[model samples]
Target: MASSSYFEDSSNELTCAICLQLFEEPVTLCCGHSFCSSCLENYWESREESTACLCPNCREVFPQKPKLQKNVILARLVEQMKLREGEGSHSVGGQAEGKDGEGDVTVNRMVNVGGHESHCEVCNEEAAMRCVPYETVCCERHMKPPKHKGHNLVEPEMKVEDPGCTEHGNSIHFYCKDDESLVSLLCKAEHQDHEVVPVEVAVAEFKGILAAKYPPLVESIKQVGSQIQQVHQEVRDTQVSGREKEERLEGERREMYRAVDEKVNHMKRWLSERQSVKLSHLEHQRANLQQEMDSLCEEESTLKASLKELEAVSFLEGYKDLLCRLESRSHFSTTEPAPPRLLDFPVEEQNVDSLIQINDNLLKEIQNGRTPSLDPNSAHRRIKISRDLRMATRTETDNPYPDHPDRFDRYPQVLSSESFSSGRHYWEVDVRSRGRWLIGICLNSMGRKGRGKECMLGGNPESWCLQKCENKYYTVHNNRGTLLSVPGDPERFGFLLDCEEGELTCLEDSRVLHVFRGNFMDPVKPAIGVYGDDGDSVRFCHLFMISFIPFCS
Candidate 1:
């Protein structure tokens, strides 16, 4: 009670000229008259002149707009009145008849002025109190109406005053619900199209709205976070598995290297043995030639000795005999001995010789091991499913696969048997020999029968897809199409669905082409399409939707 009654402003200083009530956002004019920011603007608009602007109180003429500063000191007091009213203070005015008259409302509400002092406006003496209703600062001498006294004076609530709205010189009383903005009388007039309400009412209404949705929003955030954690775990597992694979691959490589080295050594040894055999045969031939040369030399010597001893006739006879003997002896053909056939090097034919490097492709982003296949039951009658279910082709005549609700009737399409509700899933389609095809994911909730919007791929919100039409490629959803300017039709296309992130990505030839993000409210199944010129088939290289965690190798 003591603190509440410290001082009070009973003067009409708090009153606004336009509203004839408490000054809301009070502002002082250059002529020294004060008014509510809103009230002043209202007053000035009524006083606009063709030649010059005039003040309503002083009749002071000016030419342009004025400036305004907010009255922080008075704003605090208004807040205190609110606090006091909330505390259920005794009411001076009955039944909340006034804005701040709800409880313990006194004609003079005490305000802490932070020890600031002011001189009386009338006598220029140290003021004992301020008269809020009358808008005056007064000393004790001017407490009563005498030659220098005033009746409206009251105890000081605050030592200083607060400024009002700059343009209208009024308080911001109304809130524009349409724009969620605060407004004064002047502002409210300009915003006649807006749904304006009192600030208090708007506050309660907006708070209620936010409070209603808070729980669901928080829950959604938590759910998304949990999904992210799962993805993180998958990533960690992939790293560990990759490292293990790396170790295994290294071991394989070493073994292969050793085997190659052994092959090279064996080949070298075989080559050496072949060369030795060839040389041995050549050496025997060489020995026979040498022995024949020695015999010929001895025969020649005998013939020469006989020619010296006998005459021409005897020499001729001896020569003939020598020739006959040479002829009769084992004769050597005038040809070189043929070497044995040489062995050919077997490098390419060797085992563990050819190298193939398995590197990361864009499809590898999705770490999944689940290999899905076309659910034969869901295939169209004209769609021919391979025995392995990995390949599907369109034929002129229907194979008459057993009818199922999930089967597509008119379109040559098939969906994977397994549907993914959450987690990451990746699949690759070999479209190298295919000219026209559509690849994407569709909500399982989508209709399976009829050739209407319900069952149309990339024709409704229920589906997300990338398609090929004629020579052009496109991304489509809900009958809308975005043209894809690509170099050529991709050989192998990859699709990645991150249910947690609510994204569907398209990879063309192991390169990311596009990504779609939004609310994936239902489990999505892989949708394969064959249309346009369909000669080739679609092969599912890897329909990996194995589980929450999947890896290709």
Candidate 2:
């Protein structure tokens, strides 16, 4: 039998006596014994009974079946023991059960007589008792437990060794591809050239590239500036060309305007000349008409005088017939021969015959007027008498011998002659108490004389003359000391010749002349004249004529 102390010690083991380990499934037996429940049930099952009871250590038995009773105190004691063992393992080199013994050895030991014993089979010696409370253990060669199979383990070496390049079969000492500098590793060797770099050298090379390219860019910009200037010059040239064309066109326009102005002025001058010529022609026609009108007026005056004389002759004849009738009536009635009947008288018949004879002789004289053979002596006498009568009539009509007005000391007079016979004649006439007049003459009656009629005449018969006078006795002789016929009644030739301070005289004919005073080119006094016929030896026997005298200032 085991002693009470032995039983108490066994109880304190805190392990299952049936399994000889800690109580995983604790149970109570019928004999008031405690054991692992699984161990007790297994023993009951092997016996093939509904109920069983037994003492594990004492072998006591019970007739009734056993009920399970939790062993609270024993479970508390196991939990406490696990805690103490975990603490002890952590402090003592992390061992849960203990350290292993080296070498294969066996040991045997008897705890007591008739007691449970343990022995090592290898060394055959008493085994040291152990309780493996935890699940695993590991050694330094495998740093992880066998349960954690995936972890890789490395052994600690004394020094870190450089890895060898796979391509070179030597320690890697070349540049790293990532940083471009020396590195060592088999894994990093493939990317060495790309990663390894020298920081200072790379920075310097980049700056040099930028500097070398600068001048070319500046030169390119300068070339572009030159091109822009050339474009501006081209534009200026075009502008200048446009201005020159405009100036040329303006000059042409001005020249065209001047040409038009000159043409217009020439036309104006031509028109003015044409108008002047027309005016001159009109004036000439007017002057010729005026001269014809004056001639007609003189003829009208002569016709009127002839009609008045005829009327007077008719009245005188009527008076004579009336006187004869009265005388016959008073002496008649006693047959005293009827007092010589006037109706039968020869006086009336004789008068009629005489009138007829006069008419016939006038007609005959007019027809044979130029014949030289019929009664030459009487013709000569008749011519002399007619000349004398004409002289007297002219002198009377002109009033040459009239009573002088109270204003005149000696009356001034002008005499013009148509004819004077051949001789040199000189005479002096008193014009005023203070002045004397002289008359000189040269006679050339016939053309046979040394003085030809042509020589004596100075100009056209409408133009020539001589003078002898002061203001009065101013005379012009057309036939002075020459045999020149008198012109017709309405036409005469002569001039009143006078001496002025300065004058010009132009003789136009034997009896016609013009006198001008002052400059010959610009005459201040202008006069023309005509002459009447009278015999030689007659003093102042010319007919007086009046003409217009221009007033001089």
Candidate 3:
């Protein structure tokens, strides 16, 4: 406590956690928390658990009684505190004893209340009040001395008196307003040319300055708070919109599955009904055959009964009847039952042309879309960009453009200033002048630097590309390459990106070469990469419609 302010500033660090007072003999535990040695010993003894002594602060257990070692640094600070406390009390008590009785009371009252080393220096008793002018503390009975009579006094809690100047060792009664510093009698001589004011007047002036700025500062805080609230509302709306879209898509998908399931159930019912009808027809045919056999058997029985009636006359008479019946029956014709008809299985052929036309329609819808602009900041140093920033060309050397962090340092690459977060977009690049080049849509996360950078288009998972090399062309994604067997090398190629469907299609000379279905990881921009110099450049055609010259307005 070189000053009471010093102890006040570091009070938390000096105080023991258990005793709640300044440390007497500071010691450190193995777990790194320091506490008073006697307090720590009592804390452990209260538990009586020696196998694991949990730290009071961190609650971390140590295997055994950590040899409590004296914290040399903290011990020194405690000793210093003791010395400084005595010095502070001596200095303040001496100053107060030389002053009025009321001042003496103030000093002693504060000394006891603030944990100073001693009480009032004159009477060695508790102080009740302060002497404002003489800056001292004294008991009420001691305020009636000849030197203390008629002196102004206030409670010690007010602490209105200022500590004397350290340089001149004189009581501070004035404030130099120009320098904004406190000064005693001898120190005021140096500030004679400066504007000096009473200490109370200077405090009032400073208070007015602070008071003037409060309203504006509060208003600024309110303005910032309002803007933050607006941003929060907007972000909430976006989150709600995205969630709604996902829910709607799920509902629609379930509905489609339900429709397909219902169709399959209907077909099963129809098949069951058709099978029953065929079975019923076979049953009727079987019954008709049985009835014909029964009739034949009945006729034979009647003829046999007539044969048993053996009278010659009767036999002769029946003979003609039998013969006539036989002749008539022999001339009669009988029809056989027709076989049951076969039921045909209902099978429908898929339309190959219609199935193949899905990508065609998607291409048409995606082609008429978002406009793109070349980002100069993304262009490589060796690549020269047009004045309007719509075109990029390879130059002999680096251009005089200012460097940017987003610029491509390793590859001859550039990205469009505009990016697509949602919806469909299409662009065709004209690389007729260059022999080798690459064109693709890349994620904004595509790396700007490093070997095999994702921004190298076809080289990494962050992007996909349809690259051309000499007379051949290939599709690449996630560092894997696929060669395309094209009819011819098409310098003019088109790229269609469907963000919602997560599809990327490449069109070469009015024919689609490939379709990549990997979903994008983030908002994406159209990217261009080429290897050409001086006499060669890659041009972007202005088009917004499928199978048509791109028209940019």
Candidate 4:
């Protein structure tokens, strides 16, 4: 007889340390200790912030969190131990009454062991084993016969579940391929004309399908996993690049401010110097005028005193002195001081042009190839704006949008949020090839409420567009349509609206498709039009990739 301690030790081996229960989906850690996958994962999740991942049993630390590997041998052993325990319990419960009148009962475990309602089919006794070939249950007495000796036998509890139809209560033998369901012979009549086959054949067919599809599915998962990692790395790199660029731009802005301040200070100093020099010159001129006036006053007083003298000698001397002095004074010249000219800063014209050029360059760098978002307020009733505000589609049903003056009511059209009044601006649009559509720039004051030529794009003077009607492309402006002969159906096209040049050019694959030359009077915004709900949609490509001259000029 096996000792109780032996069974207890076997049970302990199959038990998990964390749950104190039999191991379910047992996995082995790096320290060679086994645990239930869920229990270990839960324990690790509770201490997720901890730097070191330590094994529960051995307290061994791993450099990184280790992946759990399933222990197949340990799992099989656990199943065997559970089956043995179940058989032992059944044996203990099976007790037969003794032959004596004392009403005593004795248990014969190996012979009469049974569980639930399982019983021998032939002897009508408690069944202990199942015959695999005959698919019947039998007791130990029947199992020992010569006819059953060569038959494959297993514990009664290990018998396969009945494959019977619940509705008809008949054994299932056929499978309906169309419905992918099991059916009995009687149930087969209900699934007439369906591809019915034997259950065994259906199982093999499904197994074959799984074998064909499994490898590709696994490969796809691996590719997606690799893409996820690549995306993660790209995100990190982009974040770092953005931060660096922002810092550089901030420093440049500060430097520009500093240069402006220094120029202002220098101009102020130059004005102060000019004012001081002008004042000093005016003061010197006033001092000379004052001295001359004082001298003339003294001479006049002497001449009057001479005239009052009666003596001939005094008169003659005074006359001669007066005449000489008057002659000398006549020879000296006194002119009126010239008027002071207004002080002006000597700003060079060429320097002003240079500063303007610098400003233009900076603006080009900032606004060149800028991606504009669609203005939801300007979307038509049938247009649906995406959450990103970059895509707009025409739908069958009207959107429940609130009343706004900017909303397009007459046509399925939408405008961009940004309006360009001047400078060369560029943007790209991706066109779907199914239905009619138009992409262009339009005046902000264009009509929006009526289904007239004024409200339609390229039908009035307020809009210029590249229209796609079926496979043909046309440039329309000012109620005029010019068919453009393009090589192929280009799905992606760009619009270059150079307000300064008074031109709007459409480009396909870097080749100019058409150009509309007209003076734009007002600020123009990017516009898109969807004719109907034929899956015809246009998306604004949010890309800032631009080269030098075309976008800047």
TM-score winner: 4
Q: Residue 472: error of model 4 in Å?
A: 0.9
Candidate 2: 10-residue stretch with minimal lDDT: 544-553
* Tens-digit lDDT track of model 4 for 128-169: 776543445567886643231124677876645565898988
What residue runs in model 3 are displaced by over 4 Å at the alpha carbon? 1-368, 548-553
Model 2, residue 213: what's the lDDT? 85
Q: Which candidate wins on lDDT?
A: 4
Candidate 2 displacement at residue 206 in angstroms: 4.9
How should the candidates be ordered by TM-score, best one leading?
4, 3, 1, 2
Better of 1 and 4 by TM-score: 4
TM-score: the better of candidates 1 and 2: 1
Worst 10 residues of 4 by lDDT: 544-553
Off-target runs (Cα >4 Å) in candidate 4 are 1-369, 547-553
Kindly list the per-residue Cα lDDT of model 3 for residues 466-534, writing each as its tens digit: 877876778988888899987755667888777888888787644668889877537888888877656
TM-score of each: 0.33, 0.19, 0.35, 0.37
Task: Rate residue 14 of model 2 by lDDT.
Answer: 61
- Can you give the lDDT of residue 60 in candidate 4? 63
Instruction: Give the per-residue Cα lDDT of candidate 3 at 58.
Output: 52
Compose the digit string of candidate 1's lDDT tens values, residues 455-477: 87898888888888786789999
Give one digit per residue, the lDDT tens place, for model 2 in 65-138: 56777788677666655655555432211112322254322112222212223322223244333212211112
